[model samples]
Target: MQNRALAAATFSFVVAQSLCGTLADADWPQWRGPSRNGHSPDTGLMESWPDGGPKQLWIYKNAGKGYAGPAISQGALYTMGTQGEKSTLISLDANTGKERWTTEIGDILGNGWGDGPRGTPSVDGDRVYAMNGGGHLVCASTQDGSILWHKSMSEFGGKTPNWGYTESVVVDGDKILATPGGEKGTVIALNKETGSLIWQSSDITDNAHYSTMVPANIQGQWQYVQRTEKSIFGIHAENGSVLWKTDFPGRTAVIPTPIVFGNRVYVTAGYGTGCKAVEINEKMEVKELYSNRLMKNHHGGAIQVGGHVFGYSDGVGWLCQDLESGEEVWSEKRALGKGAIGMADGKLICVDEGSGKVMLIDASTEGFKEHGSFTLDPQSEIRASRGKIWTHPVVINGKLYLRDQDLVYCYQVQ
Candidate 1:
């Protein structure tokens, strides 16, 4: 009898663990996963791929694209695209890659590099938020494609950046924050429910750039960190007060989001701008630790794991640097050439910009190690002219999600 009771207890524990794993795999929620950093806490994924790579689960044509990645929430996938002259926000079935709904949000702005919406959509609990290329911001219901509230940055005394508003809205608690650059405010906090202004940053009045805001707990205080053309600053999460400012000599554009580890923050930009690490003191004052040009990431953000930072260096190829001293650890220029990156299960999902080839590499401080790769053959009927596969790949729920113009592809990674 004693042996039978012990066996029953072990069986119950295994069942409970399986249920907990299923619950954690259901959502991707925001721009860069749950923490707003490009890291997914998923396990049980295939560590290596076969010769032809993982099998494509499904592909949805006419999804449109302009470098906007997908935001998965609940059981739906949200992203933005451009159809002719109109900008659209689309929701797709997460499992099958079928279109659930598409809504015309605003007109598209033609740019030199490409066109269409450039920012990733952000989905809260019940509402989906998207910003268009022309500065039109809309909040729509996640269940159905219904607009809840809409506002344009121009109407709020704001002007669009040269490249467009590429920063995904950062939702903190009950407030939504955006960079509406102008005299009114650089960063505006609005009530998530009613779309009313709660507070605005009054310290610096500068035009918006292409970087997104990252939430960080610096020295035991929560703050929002953002980088613009001139500098990088931290604002209080509770009230939008300027906590600290560090002047960075950003040239053509400062596009990459900053990464914070412990009490130090690391920021990088392209077009001659390099990377820097700044230390935050107890009083919210920032001091420069070291600055170097080892990594000049343009817009594709960087991620930190262990004690190294991994990202694409503008002229040096994909590189890794020591997070503390800004020292170059290893640099590899062979696989995936030059492009954006995403991380999942201790591996790097790199998408080559010139060719639509995706490669999986081990995220290591030693050197680059390729485990698998596949060339994406997007259907000719749904391809874009100028912008190919500029959007970054997102891995979640044991699947790899990628976008190329109007086509969104999902492949089973496990």
Candidate 2:
């Protein structure tokens, strides 16, 4: 009877975890943490760094020529870069920063800014998915880095954009979603296990941009929200049907991932396109809440903490904007230069693109208050002349990860 009770209790615990979407261990398994919101689900982190900064745990200096950030899951860190003539997906020990294995993605992508991949890897269960700049997507075994399946975005009628394919694929349940934007479809859903086509968003055929797709559950409906050069839209998860879309006059590039909270979706871009927010109703109606130039974030991603959004604007420096009213809360231009932003433990981590400087700021609406700051030691010498540090920061498991070209630095933030 005791053994029977233990079995029943274990079963109940598993069921509850599945229903709540809880994992046994903490993981930053994709582009922007678990939810792709530039927020880490980590607590008990150091609120302020000591004098200089957090303690450097390890620095693996051979990440290769790419701006892709690291994705960590189950003690393994995954990222992509270029090696010789091929783009490669690499896995490293999350604790010691030791190389574990690597698999070639495809031919190397030669671009003016840099010559390598750009999209981060997405780890789901025991399989990991990654994309090269040339639109080669591959799924491989997480344990051995063995290829399970592969596909090309060009096969789905996608035309390579000026910047290449920089969007990380979304893995949700049984489907993996990608934006291979063109006339045939804007987004394509494939069977996660077999790499077979599930469906495509045929209604909207905009060119793909650099932003990644975000999955949201709004109005009790599951959908994937994405931003392109022309519009911001949501597609039904089960089918590739377009639920709603709104026009966005994006310029040179629309690079930031769309942020979805509750029933509202917020998107921003650089090149003076500005930012906008729209709310979706249960009946699939879309209403633009506000549109303004308060946050013209180019590539550095934005984070939403509480009711405010924090990021670097083009004209303005580091700034915080009210998400509800589309107004500037505060601006701190001299604090940090244009770069990426991430959040953890009630604080914001900001990086400077020109110099590899990292700063910890209060994620508050009152003002731009910083707790600590540090610059990257031994910054990459092989970095392109025009390529400033573009990779976004990732914090999970009490560690902060930053990448500059081939140099990947890990700091103990606990």
Candidate 3:
């Protein structure tokens, strides 16, 4: 009788463990969340923190060495990192800091700033898609550390950019899109299931940049919009034909993903590149609305709420920029230092890259308002001395996830 009771208890525990990361309702299945806009659809979150910060649920210190954030899906948290020579994909129990599995994708792609993977894995039903620093794209099983198929971006005549391959491959229905920057083809789509070539942006052969592409629906027509070093353009989703292109000279490196709202597409870069918004019509014509040094977001990613965009703008600090007009609503440097940002439930979640300071602020066009803030303890000491906390904060399923190289923190914000 005692043995039977113990067996039943063990089975019950297994069932509960299996249900942890599978809650698709609030899962962050891809980069920049489900919409790729850095906005979480979660609600009922705490309007303000009590004191230090929301309760730190747990911290997984063995996240390996990487600056990438976690992608939560199906009761699991998916991410990548490196130990020594191998850059690997790691899956963890979302509710706990325990690692479920790890798969070696390839050798570590060394970089001056940091090493290991930079792109977050895009999780689909049972599979997760990710790109390594060496420009290898792998489609693997989310259930276990098993590779279904792997392909190198160089196979399509694409070369790694200065900062490495950081663009999270955009996955649409039945297809996966990636940029192999160079004269060969800027953007290429492949069969998400079989890894077969679908089409490449043949006419527009520009080198790949470090920004993720966003899917746009212009007047009921389907298209993909992206920003490169030299230009911002849109391509047909079906055939990968260039629909419209506009030259916007980008300085240094253009890291932020292009923002799309209604018919307007906005692009911004660091090193005084500033910001530019262009309007595209259904006729595939492009016209510039405004360009200025208002929100020169380096990489922390700006989020659009209502009619305002919020991000950590260089020089100007955390800024709120108007979407329709390229004007600064407000800029506050005292609230937080320049870092990666995210949004959920009408609040801005920002982490200072230099210091491990995490802040929660009101996402308002009126001005910068702080609710509460806290500094990350037990941060990654293994990180490089010159390294900054470059990983963007991700909030999903009423929880907040942030990374400092190998250290991953989970907090209850709701």
Top candidate when judged by TM-score against the true structure: 1
lDDT of candidate 1 at residue 372, scale 0 to 100? 90
Quote each prediction's TM-score: 0.95, 0.94, 0.93
User: Which residue runs of candidate 1 sit more than 4 Å off their true CA positions?
Assistant: 1-25, 379-386
* Candidate 3 C-alpha lDDT tens digits along 1-414: 999999999999988877653434568888999899999988889998878888999988776777777899867999999867899999999988799999999889887788888888999889999999888899999988799999899988899898888988888999999999777798999999988899988899888888999998975778999889899999899999998999988987888998999988888898898999988876889989998988888988888887878887889999989899988888999867899999988899989999899989899877888888899988888787667899999988889999999899999988
Model 1 root mean square deviation, Cα atoms? 2.2
Encode model 1's per-residue lDDT on 1-414: one tens digit a residue.
999999999899988888776754467877888887799867888999999889999988876657788999877999998777899999999989888999989999778777888888888888999998888889999988899998888866788888788888888889888898888768888888888889888776788898889988999999899878988898888888889999888898888888888888889999978999999999988899999888899766788888898989988989988998999999988766778889999999988877888899989986999999998876334444555566888988888998877778999997
Pick the winner on lDDT between candidates 2 and 3: 2
Question: Which portions of model 2 show Cα errors greater than 4 Å?
Answer: 1-24
lDDT scores for all predictions?
Answer: 0.85, 0.91, 0.88
Pairs clashing in candidate 3? 20-75, 21-74, 21-75, 21-76, 22-74, 22-75, 181-208, 182-207
Q: Order the candidates by TM-score, highest first.
A: 1, 2, 3
How close to the true structure is residue 123 of candidate 2, measured as C-alpha lDDT?
A: 99
RMSD of each: 2.2, 4.1, 5.7
